[model samples]
Target: MSSMKYKSSEEFHDHLLGAIEKKRGYHLKRFEEHKSEQDKGAVDALAWAYTLIKFGKGNIKK
Candidate 1:
């Protein structure tokens, strides 16, 4: 069997959530910086991060 990086499922879930949150924060900052320029790509990335976090928060279980 393959080895698991996380000690347990809850740990993995928390890690995943943290990663998504970090991405969201990064994209939010980028979006703010580019908002004056009307950057579509930055907006899309921020939206994607928001959607992923929303879904992940609702669907993932410990």
Candidate 2:
């Protein structure tokens, strides 16, 4: 993985997108271990992306 310090925030956020996919697969695999979906879903990557944009990670305005 590329280090965030060396990459632009745009690059870092792009890389984070891929990581999010992998994380979803991992979390899905552990479904049985979770007592409730809510416990595993305080927020997903897509939601965070909106946050990143809205609060100022990407290009969207608040």
Clashing pairs in 2: 52-57
RMSD to the hidden true structure, all candidates: 5.0, 5.4
Report the C-alpha lDDT of model 1 over 1-62, residue by residue, as the tens digit: 99668777667767766776676667667668766444446556656865776566646554
Per-residue lDDT for 1-62 in model 2, tens only? 97346256676666666676666656655654774575356336545654564466565222
Cα deviation at 1, candidate 2, in Å, is: 13
Off by over 4 Å in 1: 1-4, 36-62
Candidates' TM-scores? 0.53, 0.42
| Clashing residue pairs, backbone N/CA/C < 3 A, model 1 | none
Highest lDDT: give the candidate number.
1
